[model samples]
Target chain A: MGEVIVITSGKGGVGKTTSTANIGTGMAMMGKKVALIDTDIGLRNLDVVMGLENRIVYNLVDVVENNCRIKQALIKDKRYPNLYLLPSAQTKDKTAVTPEQMKKLTSELRNEFDYILLDCPAGIEQGFKNAIAGADRALVVTTPEVSAVRDADRIIGLLEANDINKTHLIVNRLRADMVKEGNMMSSDDVVEILAIDLIGIVPDDEHIVISANNGEPLAGSDCQAGQAYMNISKRILGENVPYLDLEVTKTFFQRFASIFKR
Target chain B: MGFLSNWFKSSESSSDIAKSRLKLAITSDRAVCSPELMEQMKNDIIKVISKYVDIDTKGLDIKVTRTELDDESGTVNAVLASIPIKDKRPFRG
Candidate 1:
């Protein structure tokens, strides 16, 4: 009985795909059989993020439409042998997949993989419903901005209404300097407003963009965002890992000194 | 003198303002009522009460908020309306 977690945010461009790619890769690096599903359908990008777009011969629509076997549609990651991506169909719309089909797909995947992560599209529409239909838990991603937090709150309410009660928050793209200057909401502030358990916070790092451009997830790397993703993965595996200390990025000496403490 | 004055100024941070605004917006959102709807409801209540007694519309305040339950089980969406009564209307009958 594997766990199926949905990565969702009601607003676009909040790093849902990036989190899904990194966390799935992070879990695979830890020796778990993980499958990442891009439920975005027409706006598919998870394959590109995972750098497996060139290897995709079949997609989610093909699998659901009985055009190919599930094994044929699964793409092996370039770096991790255990991580696989089920790419979405770029030509098909969100209406192509129903919640029942998603539930059945996840149930079948659950028998083989340790974790199945669904990268949901941005909205409270049919795609969101389909992604969460088979999920056992949810990780709501949001930035520290007002609009992102507002949409996060909306997503939380919808998740609860659908009875997916095991939900956690990941506040991404936090600027430590802005937070220190009282110009942006801290993670604590975000958690207080959303009234949910926080899983992790990824600092705003340029390395994240670089890794995304290269189609390589930063989870196993030594960058701050990479470390953050790795920590989030450990937490997902039921480890009692502490949150990443954002202030560690302030000084070179401190970053070097803290490595010894680890 | 500059530091002292700065300390006494008591200006709110931008994040603080954002927090308060989000709180207010979410409270109304969970209540399933927009700001316009809340205003309309307030006016209707004022009109109905005004026929029976003189009410101070200027002093009226209505807010949508969350209230903690008595048993501490969880909080619930609540509407808190404060209507000031000025005087009773004379009976025509």
Candidate 2:
């Protein structure tokens, strides 16, 4: 059976869609049958982020509304095998789907896939609720900003309230320079505040924007952010992978001295 | 010398301020109890404990936190009260 994991952040533009795309693609590369479902309803973007928008004929609403079979609604990825995407209905709003309907669809999906990642919409509204309804676990993504961390804390509380106790934290877009200057929070700081298991920390990289616009997530790429996402996927697969040294971009002397200190 | 000073300043990062503020905020947010309620409870605790010995109420810190239960089933919301002392002697009866 598969586990349905919801990627949510109460604040918008916190990289929930990007994380969903990259992590799902990484998991599929490990030979695990993975599926990414965009539950953002009218504000669908995961299909485009994964560069599969042109192929989406039927969407989540079609599957739940009986317009098509679940298999018919699934769009196979062109790049990665054992990976699929279930696009959201761009015409209808979040109210078009309910938590109960999501539960039904994911329950059916569990039998076929190893991991089903739900790309949740922002806020604590109906869209967020519907995305998490079928989820057994949650990955709360947040940037190091105070506002994003505050909202992520609230989302974690809400997930636990709904009996989804197995929640993890993904601190996204961390800038080492800002953190060194005391202008940004470190990943350790976020973990201490949110009090959840640390799953991954994706650095703030320009490649993310470039890849997203080109309809590709940073999966399997050799960039720093791509490597982090790959590490997170391995952790999800029960492999205890240590985090990469994000502070590796230091001056040559600093990097050399650190080896002796350790 | 200016560059060296800048590097030292980063060690005392403003993250300390954020950590303290967030800790207080999340304690209130847990809804185990409100901040006002926790203040009242802390006062009452000091009053009760003070009958036995002198306490430094100003230094007392009481907050609601989550603690894992021994049974490993789930967590339980708990109140942690740390009261500093001013003197060791008991109050006169």
What TM-score results for chain B in every one of the models? 0.62, 0.65
TM-scores vs. true structure, each candidate: 0.84, 0.86
Encode model 2's per-residue lDDT on A1-262: one tens digit a residue: 9999999999999999999999999999889999999999998999999999999899999999999999999999988879999999999977999999999999999999999999999999999999999999999999998788888988987898799999989999998877875668899999988878999999998999999999988877899899999999999889999987887467899767755653
Best by TM-score: 2
Q: Which digits, one per residue and each the tens of the lDDT, describe model 1 over residues A8-100?
A: 999999999999999999999999999999999899999988888899899998998889999999999998888999999999878999999
Model 2 CA deviation exceeding 4 Å by range: A250-262, B1-11, B34-60, B70-73, B83-87, B91-93
Fnat computed for model 2: 0.39
For candidate 1, the TM-score is 0.84
Q: DockQ of each model against the real complex?
A: 0.32, 0.34
Worst 10 residues of 2 chain B by lDDT: B1-10
Name the docking class for model 2. Answer: acceptable
